[model samples]
Target: MERPIDFSRDRRMLCGICAHQWLVDLEWIDRWEQSREVCPGCGTTCEHENAPRVTVDPDDLALDDDKIAQLAWYHTSTLPDWPTRDFDPAADLTPETRRMMGGSKRVAAWAARQRGKALHVGTYESAIHNMLRRMRDQADHGSQFYLYRVLLMPSVVVREGWLIDPGNFVGDVVLDEVCPPGVDVARYLNYHEDPGGLSLALGRGAVAGVQQVAVPLRDACNNDWVREAVADLDGASDALVPATGRLGRFMRPSSPRAFLGRELGAALAGKLPVNLQDQFASAAAFDEGDNPMRWARRTSCLFDLIVVPLRALAELDRQERRTV
Candidate 1:
């Protein structure tokens, strides 16, 4: 059994030069104060005295069954028939079929291999981001998208180290365990080969009963506004440095889809100014009224199952027609 470390005591440190952030235990910070340490992000020797440090409060790190029940979680997909409530990671795919799967299916299989069998869900923003990402990558010209609002059972056991600073949690690595001596870290640490840690919770029954409601967005991928925004973002991202050699088969170490989703989400939220802001205006308004963020914020934990009424679905279709 792994020993539980108190995350409330962890201190978040940021590297001034690279802007890389990481979480370290109190002991690690104490040692760093005595002697400067090498930054994992940029390999620069950072002086502890000048580095930014913030200790996490106990309340901020608190997660329990009650808290899990209170918050809404979500998952998004382009596949209309994709399983929502009872997710079997291995499902119908065999080893051969798993290898043959492409796009999100392939990613899902890979996640199951890395993180074991559990339904993956996150905050409302994450769900919207995921939907946009799928539309940008996998959706057809007339493809629709589904947004699922997931309700976790009050008895759900959420894994620790995931709720706060998830990027650091996911990116945490032991060089010796993952990379062989004299081998390039980039070669092994890219998306395809990295050993993920989510299995620590998923494989242990962290999720029990789950209920979900699917909201269909018709012709979402075909919306002219969405197309313009996606095109603009894709062009910008493609100009960045590309991965080389064998690793090119996978993807960038930095997950570009997530980055694009965040950028697009921010743009939609009016938090960022983009060249296509005018084009995205109508879509942004539609998003504001009928989005995962709004739904997640409005509902309470009392409802065991929530479904969108037919009138609401009609309203969504009407909204889409107006936006388009």
Candidate 2:
């Protein structure tokens, strides 16, 4: 079993430098939620500040039963047919993408390797946080549009590289406060709003566009009906960096769609769609004002039974382990 350690136990978080030195039992996650943990050294607010948090452990999961039933109802009734997809860590990704996925945290990577040997599974946050450990590489890999393009964002970037400078890809991209190292990203994303109203940041003192592009995702498209159910599952998988809105749960209606287009028809709102408003109207439907997140408790139950055990990452061989 993975032992829970206090976040600030050894690491002293320096606000100005964004660097952390390991200490003991600091458990500073909640401290960041209330306010930014300042550095004892130079006293500048960090652009990024966070305490790592992972998926609720199965033993520690908090969902109830009724909500699980609702998720099942949506699966049987509302979800559109989809197909199966598979997760392959060895799959070639852009240099930047791997960086976002924490392709290089020695500790986290070591944990992953151990899992393969022991057939152990990782909580989603555990897998991704470890990948993002390379804070210094952000700029060399990408910038603001990188934040916009969650699709290709790198997991690891240098403090200087955090935001791609304003230029070819987009505009000046940077971090409002650099959380440097020892900052917890999961806790940060869940805690305070992005600096200056920017939900995502970039290079030092720079960022790309104000309008962030969201991806199109819905219950019908998910549920993996198009392919083998779990094969195509993206929401909760450690390998795939989940898009926004994971506070609820992954892979369900709780997560917002990429845009407020087809589903919530502009026809009802009286705004006309420039292209194929009719078609989009036919497609986008809230169905009911049911917050899918409420069903997360229930969906989690079914998912634990269906998806969790089937993940084969723990079964990788020595060669595969080395590659990951």
Clashes per candidate (backbone, < 3 Å): 0, 71
Name the regions of candidate 2 deviating beyond 4 angstroms: 1-20, 23-27, 33-36, 47-324
TM-score of each: 0.35, 0.20
Worst 10 residues of 1 by lDDT: 188-197
Query: lDDT at 235 for candidate 2?
Result: 30
Model number with the top TM-score: 1
RMSD of each: 15.8, 20.5
Worst 10 residues of 2 by lDDT: 70-79
- Please, what are the lDDT tens digits per residue for candidate 1 over residues 263-314? 5554443522221223222223222113333322222110111122332224
Residue-level lDDT tens digits of model 2 in 1-324: 122321112222223243433221223433443456544444433344433222112222113222211111000111121100122333455668667767767445644443222111123222222112211123211111101111111232323212211112321222223334532111112111111111122221111111121112113133422233223222332222344565636543432322222123333312321212232233323223323342222222222222332221221111111111
Q: Model 2 scores what on Cα lDDT?
A: 0.25
TM-score of predicted model 2? 0.20
